[model samples]
Target: MQEFAFELALCAHLERPDRVVGRQLGAAVHGRRVADVCLVEPGPEFDRRAAVTPHTIPPLAIESDAGPGTARPVAEAFDCHPDRARAVAERAVELGFFEREREGASTAVRQTVRYPEQWFDSLVGIENKPDLDRPGDLRDQLRIDASLGLFDEVVLATETYVTGAHLNRLPDAVGVWRFDPETGEREVVREPEPLATDGPGIELLDREPGRAEVRPVTAAEKRRQRRRIAERAYGKGWRTYELPDCERCAPSDAEPADLADARLPWCAWTDGLVRPVADCGPTCPGYEPVDGGDSDGDAEGVPPSEGPEAVRARRSAWEPDPAGVDRRQAGLDRFL
Candidate 1:
């Protein structure tokens, strides 16, 4: 597939990505699904990446080395369509810069969302989603953002309370956007919000004809999708995913194996919580566990091996909460 200029900018914003949520408000300037807007945690890294190589640069850089103080200049030098380039600038003003990280092997979209929102402020691109233009049964855009491999579900609502005030604009629309698990298409329905209130930006009194169509999930469908979503918790939760590895896929210029012969699951590379322990080589600072134990359970007991059963284990090797290992403010500035 061809790459979007936003690809790099997106990478910059989602370097060590965790979760992403996008909502569609209007037509995307690029004639693509406008997620309307997206947000990345640790939003600073994304900013640095985009600043280094803003996609708006003309004559786009060809993997060349950047000269000194050249970050801003690159963005100014792109030779492309004025409207297209202008769209980048406009988005910068409307949606603040993103924070991404250096690229790694394997992956296209770190992750994708319900719809890439259209930030152009013009309704010209506001046609129904390709998968959502149906009259009305049920429809939802169920996609797994491939970024950090943590966020997995986006519940599509015809109009929802998205970050930038979605559902604020829209009238005479008659149908709810839903996902049909069996057929996997957006559906339209004639019901309003399940609760007694009008959701977020929707006004209760303005129940005009065809104004409030909602395709709520049936109890059975809800259960099935819910289970499906739950099983896919990694892209949506703290669980990690297994990375495929094979002979050619493995490193070619790799170092010989250690006598210990222990390797953490590749998923540990991005798993937020128990990550430190995964890199537990003698040379790594995270090499030693907080308490030198097998489980983060208690202060006493020779627990089972965390990674190696033959190796001795102790209760002292774990942090009180395994999740605290990657904490941003544990104040281990100079020391772990």
Candidate 2:
């Protein structure tokens, strides 16, 4: 629960008009290495990408041979099985990334717009430990991240007072930041060195007492994985939780003055942020039912308004509803 509160506070602080912030994203190319936070800096074609769809454009659709100029049969465009290709195409069309056309008996699809390859500039992966005193596999995680070089920069965010010994334990390329979840203040303990994102990288797969297993990742694979990460971050922002049905939940006053609008799960009874899934329920003494039942304290229910979607749309570069470009024409001869 400490880590959850810290992560939400950090995400609120990191969100801005120029960048998109997401949490708990898969960052590893081979092994399972989930990043606590992913900051996506926008590129020149950011607006174009946003205009396409509010949801993620399936990676398979982007990698297929479909183009805006020519309509290709779904089976011919995708290398996967016919059913999977059709399903992926249908999803892409639903997301406004692809348009369908009737080509004789078979269905053909074409991209509504060219995939914006430069929509995102860079990705920064952050690992949160909050308490360095209980450092569990922190060194191994940082080492894996550095060797993979998937992200342009990697940093460790914590509330612990980092010592010189802690600095020595971390990789040189990994940076450190001291973050205060209560005050919303951050201090950079060390700046991160840039990784070789353009070149090949080594992925640390497994390590035993005597032997270590690794995989050599090519530059092309890294590029594809980077795009997948960006797409996921764009679709899934950091506010992935819902406010519990408790009268004590007050978002307006829970966060700091600057972050009050974030709509975090702040519990008035506890006088601190609370994880609704874990900290909230009938078992909690402060959990007054939202339906206006008997309560120990004077209870006023949570106010009604638009949910986190509206908050995210107002705060970040994401578009909740975009004017899509999936309009289809009546003729197949034009596509041919």
Candidate 3:
């Protein structure tokens, strides 16, 4: 099976029980590679409460000769004003929520933001390798993950048959799993050893072969890094698959629970989850036409094209809302 298929099945399985799954995430920590699949547990009740309530203090506005901007109270661009916004900004500065910057003429400003930190309980990283025989840098990458100790747990999810030799090469702390993409079956070969997130960590450096250097990370730094990583994961979930704009394949017709897990909309007509792309459309055997009003028809004046490049161009027009809902009705047509 292809790695994409394996990753998709894994994502479907992970989405169960309300775990958030993100794929191909840009590494939040510097010097780390992009994670193949990242699973983050929901944050605590405190974090959820904080997310719903806005900051009591309003952001400070910075008016300049060029234009208007907002700055943290500590920023050089931050000129004190006797307003409520200033009071809140000033308090935030005192609380160490803002990092100050002073530029030559225009003071560069930065905002130290806080996320729903309590909402994220743990981060689990998975490396998908469909063919272990063609392993390239797999061992090194897992080792780096182990040494860096960024994720609470790291595991290798592969379709390849596990052997004693393969296990011997990988770090004992890292977990191993046998995955079957077709059946969505997963078997755990080794349970991962939980890494210490509350304490200081060691950042690994690929300085020399067999002689990796390490840097000490303070607990405060780790906390900040964890938040950054979790925020990215929240924005980029594993539901990267796009829905085909077919009249017969209206998302509302699909089972919401099944779609949430599979990332593929279920077609009751087909009695299964149809491919999000090519397998959908009027020409398909299971296609059942609906009102063209909701379909991406030529009523919008844009002709459809089937080439890969054209498909990519079309996909770019759609964007996922923060809540992961597909708001197809957004953009130019809304104006009409």
Candidate 4:
């Protein structure tokens, strides 16, 4: 199967229950390393109360020029969308997320939410490899992930059957999983070793044969790293892409007969499951005018609306708490 198809199927399986999963996340500690999939499970501290609920907070307002050194009032920031921003600014004031103060005889409001720090628990990283026959530089990459110890666990998932030779090439700390993309089923062949998130971790600065350089990580440093990663995962949340809002190919329009196996998106034009990334715009050959537009009224090729409100509507697909507010304070205006 294509790697992308495998990844999507694996993602669907990982998100089968209440688990929140992210794709293509950057988890490098010293260098730029991106993980194929990231799974986050909310801890006891994950405040469901902080979840964005209608009328629970005010509409958000922000200065148009949010660049550094641009001092502006929070209220002035909401000038563009006065009605919505005003209500959000008010709620922000009430919830202590925004602090209203006087500066040089003028009132100013600033955000105070520490974010992901107050909302996430643990993060797990997964690397997808559909064909182990072509394992290119997999060793070094897994080695780096294992040494960083940023993730609680690192897993290598592939469709290839497990072999002793494959295990020998990989670090034992990295777990192995046999996955079947067609069925969206996965079995853990090797359990991963838990990484120490609170203690010093080996940082591979330079490694060349006998000459190797590493740095010591303090618990405080680990804490900072964890917060940074959690904050990123909270913001990126999985489901970076969206399905085309095409009525003809929409799940709602699929025939009852085709609804089996979850009916995957069926296209009357193509007479089969539409390509996952197939273009379904008015310009496409398969485009057929439907009586009604997309349920959301947004046309094909148009990405879903972004912002706290949109996220709250699709939170489960985006973050651990699909019911919660967007972790990014900038997108928290949904409550307003």
Identify the superior model by TM-score, candidate 1 or candidate 2. 2
Error of 4 at 113 (Å): 5.2
lDDT of 3: 0.57
C-alpha root-mean-square deviation, candidate 2:
3.3
Each candidate's root-mean-square deviation in Å? 22.0, 3.3, 12.4, 9.3
Give the top-scoring candidate (lDDT): 2
Error of 4 at 279 (Å): 6.8
Residue 2 local lDDT, model 4: 63
Error of 3 at 152 (Å): 1.3
* lDDT of each residue in 23-140, candidate 2, tens digit only: 9888888888888999999999999999998888999999999987778999899999999999999999989899998779999999988899999999999999999999998988
Over 4 Å off in model 4, which ranges? 52-96, 105-118, 205-216, 245-292, 295-336
**Residue by residue across 289-319, what tens digits does model 3's lDDT show?**
6644543222122342232223222332111
- Candidate 4 positional error at 300, Å: 22
Tens-digit per-residue lDDT, 105-170, candidate 1: 311110111111121111111123223233232221111111101122122333221222233222
Per-residue lDDT of candidate 4, residues 1-336 (tens digit): 666756755665665334456678767666667888888776655554235322223323322222123334655666556566656666665654455555576555655443324455677888888899988767777887788888889999999998999999998899999988655567989999998776777766666778977676666666666655654555555545554556566533333321212223445566444444655667777675555534222223333233323532343433223353332355434532
Clashing pairs in 2: none
Model 2 TM = 0.92
TM-score of each: 0.19, 0.92, 0.59, 0.64
Best candidate, TM-score: 2
Lowest lDDT sum, 10 consecutive residues, model 2, at 294-303
